[model samples]
Target: MTEPKNLALRENKVPEPTASFWTIKVLATTVGETAADLISSRLHLGTQLTTVVMVALFLVVFVVQFRSRRYVPGLYWLTVVLISVVGTLITDNLTDGLGVPLAVSTGVFAVALMATFAIWYATERTLSIHDIVTRRRETFYWLAVLFTFALGTAAGDLLAEQLNLGYLASAGIFAAAIVIVAVAHFVFRLGAIAAFWIAYVLTRPLGASFGDLLAQPTSDGGAGLGTIVTSVVFLAAILTLVIYLTIARSRRAVPAKDRQTGIEEPAGV
Candidate 1:
């Protein structure tokens, strides 16, 4: 069904945090982990150079995302995928290039993320992604997303590598953590916004650990699929889902008033 005409003018810039959103987000996060390893190792670009290239791509996509008045599934997902890579690399740089401890990186990112949310809530009076309509709110949203990724990376690596939990075990732990967050939200009546951000942060580590479990060598307790194969498989999955979401969105009618005002209302919201 088409959205009500009156509601079209207040379209949010982000997608609803539905099952599909989380599915694609986890897939994109996996791609971010495997693809970064593929580029840095298989392509011989090194982590620093790979980070530079991905950040540039992320900025370009961010421009496209910011210019769009409403959530375009393809554009929004593309931004997510790129930012995922950039966030992973940021943590990698801190841990590897600068010799920062995983615990330190994790703590720093956690603090940064908390600060971003505090400022965002203080300024906008809400931390709900559903309220991201204005540019300022969208900016805060993306910044928060970046920190989630960085923090997730550091925490995941600390568990899987530094602490020797192994990738598969790490994935299991994170997956269980997500389930606990869900139970808290649905069963214990935790706030929707709180549950969402918690789950979002947890998914990053879960996805990354799963990627490593697939991409690392068998000697390392992984499946030995290698980064290239893992990256390709997850990326193809992400692309298929994105294409489906884009078509599903396009089939919805655009509100005429919104069209006249050069604004697009998100379909299937």
Candidate 2:
């Protein structure tokens, strides 16, 4: 069945937030946490060097992402994966390298994220990801992404270490929060942008706690899966999903035009 042209143009132009999107996001965030550990702890590169490497890789991926005319799932997911790792390292640095407490890091990142949103809204007058076509909006998007990851790391550690909740419990708490956000959005007419950012921030800790639960030693309340194994498994899953998305894109028609802007829109426009 053909979708209404207007609905196709206005509603479905941007990639729909489907099961696959969430799957890939969770896997990417898990990989982000584990991959950082793989580089810093397993390889003994130290946090500083690992952060440098991850940030450099993130830049390369971001360049590719920004250069793409439309949202290619593989490119978009790859950028997310890299940014997750880099963002984790940023918080880890403040906590480990500089000896800052998790509470302090969390508060700092929260403030920074709020500031980013405030400036973004003031300059663009809209915080909608659905309208992210301009370079300025893209910049704000990435900055917010970075802060979300950092804040998630700090918040997750605070729960796991400071509160003694353990990884499994922390993951459960975050998962519950995500559900509440979904309910608020769908049942209460919550704003789309607010719901999306709330969910996005929560996914970080959900993924981070899950990663810790899988990768930490059995004595540490984990299953002793190890960072390398966990990272590889999630990365493989992400790659498979990206490949499927790429092939699917080729089979679809040119995405419809946006009604509001009267422009050819990308899927998930």
Candidate 3:
């Protein structure tokens, strides 16, 4: 049977979040944080210059992603990685460059994320990533994603810097929070959309902490791998997975719009 043209237009062009999807998500988040540090700190480009370069790259690849007919793993995840880096840079700019407090940045990003969701739901009557077949919906999805990353970056930094939790402790805290979110979803029957977005936001800090633990110096409590080494490893891992997914064509069109308006099946959702 032919798909309804309208529905088809709004079908999600991204792959369903899967095991590998989650792996890549966390890895990309790590790379985002460390890679941003590499360019700004080690490369001596400074935050402003690094932000300009990454944003330019993001815009270029984002155009490719926006124009594609369907999910292209390379382009899709490339956009994610770029946006992730850009998101980190945005938070870093506010906190480090402008001397804005992490707590303030966190709260501001949280509000921005909430406002974006409100506007998206107000216009579409749905916040479903499944409704992403339309350009407008895709726009909302990417906006939400950007906010989540920014929020995550701010929140993570707040915990480490202001709270004095340190990277490993911060990673532990976020990891525990993710486990709680999982418990809520599976045991208490938490709404899928709420759970997804919550966990999505939480993972940013968790991944950032992990990245810092690996990349920072031993005296600073990291493993001594350094940002360049850590970023290289994570990027290599990401490259391998993207190549595999591309060759495998792991993406699947959802059987239909998610009826539950909640969490969805990997293939159909």
Candidate 4:
């Protein structure tokens, strides 16, 4: 695939895939599930109102994210956290508010995700996050991410609630799937891009199942942590990690003279 043209910045719009990246991503997914529950169920805002408020907030943050020239850890991850919540809300709306079956929601989101990827590949000739330097590519990247979260939510809930697998079992299943993907990528030489996206999609379900395992009551086969406690703990962890990432990125950045002399520093998490 060709390199993205007219690249005004050295860094990709998205962060590099690192251990920290996956850590924050999974944390964000867990927060998405529990925080949505906290707002809609615990806080008495109702699903419909919470969705509207969150969508508005997401658009506002999204514009800020789009206007940035390079990845800013705080802004970038804020967008991710918000999008995660929005995605969960979308799936919840489908199943709870609209009375749609979890299986149907899962199927619909999977197809939508596939369609987004198809169009993304057709238009850009690539689906690598490393290539997300332009607005159009970033748009596709976020669309794919949104669909993955929604799809994962449906699939996780279908297994945990509908099929009576329970939250812990669902978490175990998705975790195994992620482990298999890692083995394929590291040992079997799966393509980096494919492995990354597949694992990315899997993390959503894994994180959601974990969140539910903590947040739901003991009768529901969970640990009885409740949504508020789970959301607070995860969000705090996310904030700490993002702060470290921001500091690390600043320290890794090269001086203007180095940039002018064409000394390219290797990218980091």
Best by TM-score: 4
lDDT of 2 at 169: 98
Per-residue lDDT tens digits for candidate 2, residues 90-129, read 9889988899999999999999999999999998788887
TM per prediction: 0.90, 0.88, 0.89, 0.92
The whole-model lDDT of each prediction reads 0.90, 0.87, 0.89, 0.92
Q: Which one wins on lDDT?
A: 4
After superposition, the stretches of candidate 2 with alpha carbons farther than 4 Å from their true spots are: 1-14, 254-269
Candidate 3 lDDT for residue 266: 73
What lDDT would candidate 4 get against the real structure?
Answer: 0.92
Q: In candidate 2, how many Å is residue 257 off?
A: 18
Give the TM-score ranking, best first: 4, 1, 3, 2
lDDT of 3 by residue, 109-168 (tens): 999999999999997888876557777778888999999999999999889767888999
Off by over 4 Å in 1: 1-10, 254-269
Q: How much lDDT does candidate 1 score?
A: 0.90
By lDDT, highest first, what's the ranking? 4, 1, 3, 2
Question: 104-187, model 1: which lDDT tens digit per residue?
Answer: 999999999999999999988899998887777888899999999999999999999999999989999999999999999999
Q: Is candidate 1 or candidate 4 better by lDDT?
A: 4
